[model samples]
Target: MSSKRMATIMGVTYGIAAIMPFFVGDIRFIMHILIMCLIWAVVASCWDLIMGFAGIFSFGQVAFFVIGAYTSAILSVQWNVPSVVAILLAGVFTAGMGVIVGLPCLKLAGPYVALVTFGVHMTLMPVLRGEIGIALGSGGSQGILTIPPVNILGYTFSSANQIPTFYFTLFLSVVCTVIILAVIKSYWGTAFLALKDSEEFAMSLGVSAFKYKLMVFALTSFLTGVMGAFYGHYIGMLSTRMLELDLFCTLMVMLVVGGIGRFPGAILGAFITVTANELLAPLGAYRAVTLGALVVLLVLLLPNGVMGLWLKRSDAEA
Candidate 1:
């Protein structure tokens, strides 16, 4: 797809999100969902950039997110740093972790990379719940319970200011989306495509496979980290529960339903999955089952995900 076409979809999505609070501003529940949709959209888009476009099979997105959340929460709640500064610092911390993990892991085969990254996810829970995390003000099992809301200048964004929070999140999401799109159209993106086609060949053509992968990995980690901090501040809490399989699986469902490698599809998928998952709340315990069955049906019916419905074979994934 043309860059313009790719951007149009996101533009339209953002346009819809921009006006959502006008209609549902007073409905806290719906407003909360909208806020989550924006948050998840950017996070999912970052996942798409990694697993979909860059073809990195890392499962550490959740870990990176929780890392960011806890990092910011500890900085603000325990150390007295400003919420805004903490969030950016959280991104930097996660990106550093990404580099550390990616350094050796990226040299391995695809499945091995997945295992190593997922291993990071698996180990994070213990690290957070154990003595080490508590020393860093993690709150251990109790989790951080008193994270302050994001305060910009004199204005505060929190549950009390749902509409303002939504727009603020929208602004952040838009910035992240623009960066993702730019990366997709840049040489970094083209480098990934070449590497995907054949890393050996791409390397011969002067593309640094490991470098490009690491760069994108760090970039996505940074974005996910920022959003994670945003989520923590918005919710006024942080917990290890985010590491559970349910949220991880929901992220996978977003990519699966949105079509792996599809740019704007990630955005669409996050909205659809989050909203649908909520709508199924009345089913009680059957919600996960229904979601599983829905994913299976969608995979069988729409192999390319929802984006496949619109993009042609010759079209670019982004």
Candidate 2:
């Protein structure tokens, strides 16, 4: 399929998804699920940008996410900053940290970089727990509660109505998706792909691995931070547990399950995984085991992920 045609189809599909809540009536639970899916979809997409596209195995993605949430929460609750401002500032702060973290780690290659990132991810909880300053307002284990919802243009997203929150998150997800797709289609994206395929070859061709790696690292971190801030405020609380390795693993699962390098794979992965998780909630202890088995089976059966299967079928038909 041509790029133009593929883009048109994706646009229409996302358009339908954006308007889906309106037709679903008053099913708040479904809307909530959809919102969560979109949030994770954005995070997964950001992950795909750095790991899948740039070939940077960054396990510290969740750390930037946690930083964004905490920054937004603290700014809004302690300093009376606006929701929009807080989220943007959170993105900025997280991006700055991404630079700080990426500078040292990006110099390393392969598993070394991954090890550094994993260490960073593991340190977030300990650091947050140790923060005892009154101005910082550490949530500790109890977490920060009563967080104000996102207020945009005098309209507040209260918990009483999930529809607005749903639409707001949906809009953000769509915007982020478009941005990521645009990046993937740009010259820098070509460089990223080249680097991913062969860092040595790309460097030989004048594509600076250092520059591209840091650029993508900071850019994806910014997106993750923005999503994290929205999540913190929309959910009306912030918890250090949300930054744990489990969430990072889930994001990875979504990316791999959907088709890591494909643009639509992130959304598909998050939707399928999150919906399955919710549906399997009644399974109790077996839920984790079942989900793990499913992931292992999918990885073994469909090595390239769901989108890979679709592509293969399309090619076969052609």
For each candidate, give its TM-score against the true structure: 0.98, 0.93
Candidate 2, which ten residues in sequence have the lowest lDDT sum? 309-318
- Report the C-alpha lDDT of model 2 over 141-181, residue by residue, as the tens digit: 77779788888888997555788888778889989888888
Model 1, position 221: C-alpha lDDT score: 93
**Residue 255 CA displacement from its true place in model 2, Å:** 1.1
Ten-residue segment with the worst summed lDDT in candidate 1?
A: 309-318
Highest-scoring model, lDDT: 1
Clashing pairs in 1: 1-316
Candidate 1 has an lDDT of 0.91
CA deviation > 4 Å runs, candidate 2:
5-9, 132-135, 312-318
- Per residue, candidate 1 scores C-alpha lDDT tens digits across 1-318 of 679988999989889988877888899999999999999998999999988888888889999999989999999998899999999999999999888888887779889989999999999998999999999999998899999999999899998889989999999999998999999999998997788778888999999987998998899999999999989999998889999898999999999989888888999999999999999999999999998999999999988899888787776343
Question: Compared to the true structure, candidate 1 yields what TM-score?
Answer: 0.98
Clash counts for all predictions:
1, 0
Cα lDDT, model 1, residue 182: 95
